[model samples]
Each structure stands twice: as structure tokens, then as C-alpha cells.
Target: MNGRSRARALGVLPGPLPTGPLNAITDVAGVLVGHTTIDDGADLHTGVTAIVPATVRALPAAVHTGNGYGKLVGSTQVDELGVLESPIVLTGTLSVFRAADAVLTYLMGLHPGELSFNPLVGETNDGFLSDIRRRPITERHVLDALEGAHGGLPAEGCVGAGTGTTALGYKAGIGTSSRRLDAGGGPVTVGALVQANFGGTLTVRGVPMPVEELVPGAGRVEPPGNSCVIVVATDAPLDARQLGRLARRAIFAMGRVGASYSHGSGDYAIAFSTADPAPALPDAVLSPVFAAVMDAVEEALLNSLFMATTTTGVEGHTSHAVPYDRL
Candidate 1:
């Protein structure tokens, strides 16, 4: 939607399900997304991404950790209480804590008398391209992302938290996709956003990408451990337990995109529902939603790679973008 070519435009459809109007996480009613990219000419290529639901109050949510190698602040509480009380923020690994603090600062202003709160923040290592050790992210950057969130198509690739990220040896950043389901009792939309920075052979649909042929000598420059953070949103009435199941489906979708889920890869998925309080859907009707999650996630992961531009950062490390023409 932002003028950049996405997976669908390239005939790389991940599934048969129809997408929402915008084909983004924002397609879920009441969901909003925003980003604050910090791209200094060189050395610093990092920033923040914020996902906010309609209300500030706690919403039904769940988290799934495929590999617990990275930090995901406030995940325990969400797993225990089955709810999220703050906007979800994503950023570079080292900046996670600072981002959480910023979320707390912003939420405190919204609820004056609230004595306690849990801020959800996730991260992926971007040290390969960004000067992550410097921790360039500030409270202002995080605040800007939260305050600027809107309901519509969000910018993808080389932006926000994805600025310096890479996936499967290709430059990748933020990517998003959505699906509309009509079989789960009624029409509902499911959407996913990903900060892809992991390792493995790139795969599209089911075919492995010819990375070596397309980008001669392209190889991993980062250290062993990398990470990916996925955020899934739906407008269906699902309880925390059900959302947990949905989150797992999102994690599984990574395999469809050739994610190795390596020893050091901290892969995580956080799923939440925007539907108002109501009776949860029966287990028999959840299959369609699960399928939608996998499809949306696969497409989102591909979008992260395809939409990204080649970037050079940190010392002399360069990550090449996937050659769309070759694919």
C-alpha cells in the first residue's frame, strides 16, 4: 500500500485466503501501528515499532516462545494473566529495556491512578548492521511510535525496528500481512507483523530461493545467534488459552519461510484479540483461524525480505536485498 511492491504483487501468494482491505495488521478492527526510524547516515540504523489496540485497558493476549534466546519483556505476566495492558513495542535487542521504560512512562500519563502495569516489548539483535552496542534508541523515539500509531497500511522494510535487520542472508526489516476468514462462525480478520532477523535458506511459497546465484557470494556475516519477533492480531473473540494456541501457529509459520529456529534464534509470537468480551468460539471453529495465522505469517516474512533495500552498516558489513527480478 505504500508504493513498495509486496509479495502478492510479485505473484508470491502464500495462501488461498483473501486478505483484508489493507492486508496489514491494522486490518484488525481497533488495531493501530506506528514506527520511529533512527537512521543516521552511518553506524546507527535502528528504531522502534509500536502496536496499539483500541483501548488502553488490558486485552486478551498470549505469547509463544519458539526459542527463548532473546529478551521479550513482560511475557511472563501475559502468560500468567492472559492479558496485555500496554502497547506492544519492538526494537533492537539492547534497546528493549529502554523501550519498556518508555512504554511505562507513556502509560502512566494515560492512567493517572494506576499503581502497577506490565509493558510488552520484544526485540531482535541488529548488531550485524546497526551499532546496537550504542543503544541509540531513546524514550522519545519509543513515545513517538506509540503516539503516532494509526489504523491503516504500515510502512514495511528498512524502517522502524527492522531498519538494520536481516533474514536468511538477505536484508530484511518489518513485514506485515493479513487474512480474512469466513468459516469461524462469522467473518474475522487475522493479521501479522514481523521483525525478521534470523537465519536459514530463504524459501518462498515452497521453493527454496537461489541466494547464491542471485546475490553471488551472499552469506551470513552476523554471529551465530539472531532473532525474530512476530505480533499477531485478530478481531475474533478468543480467550487467552485460545490465543496461546493461535500464537503457536504463528511460530510454526516461520518454518514455511525457511526459518531455522537455530540454537541462538529467539523466535517469539504474541497474539491478541480486539473483539469485545463475548463467548469464545468453539474449538471446532478454530482451524480456519489457525490456517490464516500460518498463511499471513508466511507472507509477512517474505514481505520483510522482498520489500527491503540493500543496506550497508556497522564498520563495513553489507546486507544485500533479495533480487526480485531473479526470483
Candidate 2:
């Protein structure tokens, strides 16, 4: 409910190129991000609902990536035909199925007589700071985050699902960044936001630093191994194949911050473009254009890592803030 500036954090990639107005995923015209943080009871360090709304009613588009290891419900249909018709919800790992169900239920309620609604829900584990086993997220929380979604700069750090996330050796949470691409017609925008639940040695601009170097490790939650979720959004007209490429480029952003994509890391990136509406047919003859998708994906990856601040989470887990002063 309150807003504050994040501490020093590094981008997954370099900067200096043109960025969107807010340098956030929401900058991708019509995209919105919202969150709800639950910090009350001694052990209730978790809450739910972080939503990125669809740009238009029954919008047509294609999904470019696939993850066999994790479940991105509604993505299979999206990849088969390269289109999406729903909002995106990010949450704690165990809440994926529940959130997906809630999203479908909500959509059905909205449409009244709709046959299907493939809700998109993504998850990252937050058991270290939160009681994931309790499944703290609820249908009401999901609706609250969705109803509150709006186009503007998104909040960062210990908020929303990110409340329990960690990154590059510190307690980290939601971070966002964006860039404008040189489209032939005009500049297309691509932006990225992340829920950082991964941990390891912290490095920025090739300068290596121990995660503990920034913050002491006494009487705190030990950083979990790598596990992070990145959401990339753009307004470039691109097909599924191109979007997949963009998703891969996001790893470069992770590399810039000294990530090795460890065994336990659930490093996943989902990239989408709102430039062209998704047609409802599987065989719709839509001309594909992807110049902007490439640039936008790369930029968005950087944004996810850059805009985050250091945080401390459950059991006194503390992470050093990106030391802008040190830089």
C-alpha cells in the first residue's frame, strides 16, 4: 500500500538505449501490473495476487515459448497457434494450480456463458520466507490484484509475490526495466519485470561480490539456490518463434548479474508482444513481423534485474541493497 525507493541493483544487460516512459513492462501500452503484500501474523509472511492484465477484450496473439519442466497453463494452446486471450498472474510456486483455477473461475464469471478461459499463471518457490505449504494466496487476493491492475510504473522490492523472493545474494523482489526498439514504422517498446527468488554470489559490471559481503549472514534465512521468474512484455509485432528467441535472450540479463542458472534455479522467462491482436483461429494467416521483439526482449530482461532493491525476508533473511554508493 505504501511506496518507497529501491536500493542499488544491476541490470541484466547494459543500458543507454531509448527506454519506455516508465521503464517498466506496463510501458508496453495497455499492459498493467499490480501486487498485494501480506505482512501481519508472526508466520503469515505470504499473500497473493500479482496480475498483468490483457490489453484488450478477446485480443488475439501468439505464444512463442514452451516450458516442459514447469506448467504455464494456456501456453500450449498459445504456442500451437501463437496467441493469448488472458491476463498473466504470478505467484508463489505451490499456488500455480490454485491461482489458475481461480483465474478461470473469475473469467467465467465475467463472461457468464463462456466455455473456456485459459488463464496464465506463473510461479516461483518462496518457501524460505513464506509458508508455501499453507498456500497463503486466495481467490479474493487474486481478484484484488487483478481489479487493481493499471498502466503505470510498477512497484518494486518486497511487495506482491516478490515479497519472498531473493536475488544475486540478497533479498530481492519485483524489479522492472524497459527499452524502445527501432522499428521500421516507429519505435516499439519491450519491457521486463521479475520476481527474483534465486540466490548466489552477487556481481555487477563484472565485479564479483559475495552475497554475504553486502549483508551479514548471522541469524537470517539462508538464501535458497537459484529460482526466479521473469515476465517480458512488448508492443512489437512478432510471431511465436521470435518471441521464443526473445525469451532466450533474457538469460543474458541473468548472466550480466553473475547468475549461473544453477540446478535449483527455475530460471524462466515468458515474452509476449501486444502489437498485433491475436486472431481466434489456429490457422489464421497473420503476417509475422519481429524486428522489435528481439530488442524489446533484451531490454526487458535488463529491467527485471535493474529496478530491484535489496530486502530482508522471513526468519530474518537479509540481503544487501544494490550499493549504488559503492558503485
Candidate 3:
């Protein structure tokens, strides 16, 4: 009976725009999400999450860094080339190298005899909750996550790369939400997936949450400056530049959710589209896309808090989920 529900399901934080069928990032056609959780021991509370774009190959993309306080592997190339060469991976901070190498290895197996591939991997410091020094993640976990990726309702909170993450003094993890736009041409979908590990005031529907009162000893946990990795996907046929613009709106949404934009926070948004060769939308129509992203991101961040359950890790340090009664 420890099941947790989404925010909208309880009416605590309904987003502005109408959601796609699933209301999750997978609602974007062909986009897939998968995770490999590794919480084997008191100290090993970490894993990997993978997002595989529809193209099954390189796709036009962009990366926007709200704060450059992270070890984002293979980002410079994405910024320069404006194209994502591999499926994006998320994991712990210290394990970024392994995650990147694993992504590259998987791509190699798919396109054998192909060399020099760039892998995009994002991470946050799960060290506070898990024994990060052990580096529990492995290349196999990344491949498993990638191979298992699929489109549909995604499993969020306390899973995958979010397994050991804490946010706003709560046990925040993976959260995803999607918004659909009916802009005369056709219905376009924009989805956001987030690793919620940073710190903030924790707001829902414009009201600030009292994390300290909600959780026992919540005030003892550290404050902002950890990190958050937001992966956005759309079917709008946007190019690298437009995707970068769409990515930036995610930070605004983060602020809305109570992020302090602290120096230690590595806030990044990686956005791309499945419809390649489909031209980028005119700037005139891009405003709605930006709006959609902000709405979806805010809702997604709340979902992370609502869906996650209390978790106890190394040294008996427990990250309590926002108490259900408070909502």
C-alpha cells in the first residue's frame, strides 16, 4: 500500500495546457524511456536512465546550461554541431564517464565498424544518499536501460538515475509530463523528463511547501546547488537552435518550482525532435512551444515529489517523501 500517485490525479498541481494521452514524456511519438535501478545494498542506491529519440540515429538537437556546474559528457560537441549523436543517458555525477562510455559502446554495437561517436550523458550528485565512491553503475546497466527503452506511460520517482536523489529535503526522483499543442497545422507534443535532485523551497501551484515541518529533521539536509537534468522531446521538427531555445524555458519552470539557481546546481536541458528533415518551425510559432515546455516542466517536477516514496540509504540517511497527508 505504499503506492504514490501523480499530482494531477490528486488535483494539487494541474498544469495549464492539456496533456497528451499518457501525460508523460513518452507521449511524444517514438520517444522512449527506460531505467535500470541498482539499489542492492544500504550503500548502493544508484542506477541509470535512458532516453532514446525516435530517429534511432543522430538527430538535430541543442543543449542549454542554466548553470555550468556539472560534468555533462559529450556536451561541447552537441553545442557545436547542434546534433545529438546518441541516446541520452542519466546517472550519478562520478559515474558520468562510465555512462558515456557505455552509451558509445552500445551505439557501436548497433552501427558496427563505425567509430568516433559522441554520447550525451547527464548526472547529479547522488553521493549524499548513496555511497558514490563505490561507483555501483556499470556499462551493462546503461545498455539494459537503452535496450529496454519504450514509449508509453513512464515509471517515475525513486527509480533509475533518480534512485538516490533528494530534492527540497524530500526524496525526489524522476518525473515526466507532456503537453500537446493544436497550432492549426496539427497537434504537436512536447514532453519533459527530469532528474529531481536539487534543492529549493518546494512549491506546488504557487504555494511554498514547508519541507522541514513535513519531514522529520528535513532542516538538517543540505540546501540548493546539487543539480537537475531535464530532457525535453518534441515532435515539432525543430532544429538545434530552436531546440536550445525550448530547452531554456525549462529553467524558468525550475524557478517556478523553487530552484534557487544556486552555484552548485548543474541545470541543463537537452531537447530534440523525432521528425528530422522536417524544417524547424518559424519563430512566430515557437512561443507556444516555449509555453508548453514551462508548463510541462513545472508539473513534471511536482510529480517527482508526489510520486516518490521515502527512502533510507547509507548511514541510515533517509530522504522522506513529502508526507501524503500534507497534500
- Best candidate according to lDDT: 1
What residue pairs clash in candidate 3, if any at all? 225-264
Q: Please provide, for model 2 over 247-321, each residue's C-alpha lDDT reduced to its tens digit, 9 standing for 90 to 100.
A: 666654666566656666767666777766342212222121233333443343333334445444556555445
User: Which stretches of candidate 2 lie above 4 Å from their native place?
Assistant: 1-13, 49-51, 54-71, 216-225, 277-316
Candidate 3 structure lDDT: 0.86
Q: Write the candidate numbers in order of decreasing TM-score.
A: 1, 3, 2
- Comparing 2 and 3 by lDDT, which wins? 3
How high is each candidate's TM-score?
0.97, 0.81, 0.96
Q: Mind giving the per-residue lDDT tens digits that candidate 3 earns over 133-193? A: 8888889999999999998887899889998898877888899999998643777999999
Highest TM-score: give the candidate number: 1
> What is model 2's C-alpha RMSD?
4.8
lDDT of 1: 0.91
Q: Using alpha carbons, what is the TM-score of model 2? A: 0.81
| Candidate 2 residue-wise lDDT at 321 | 51
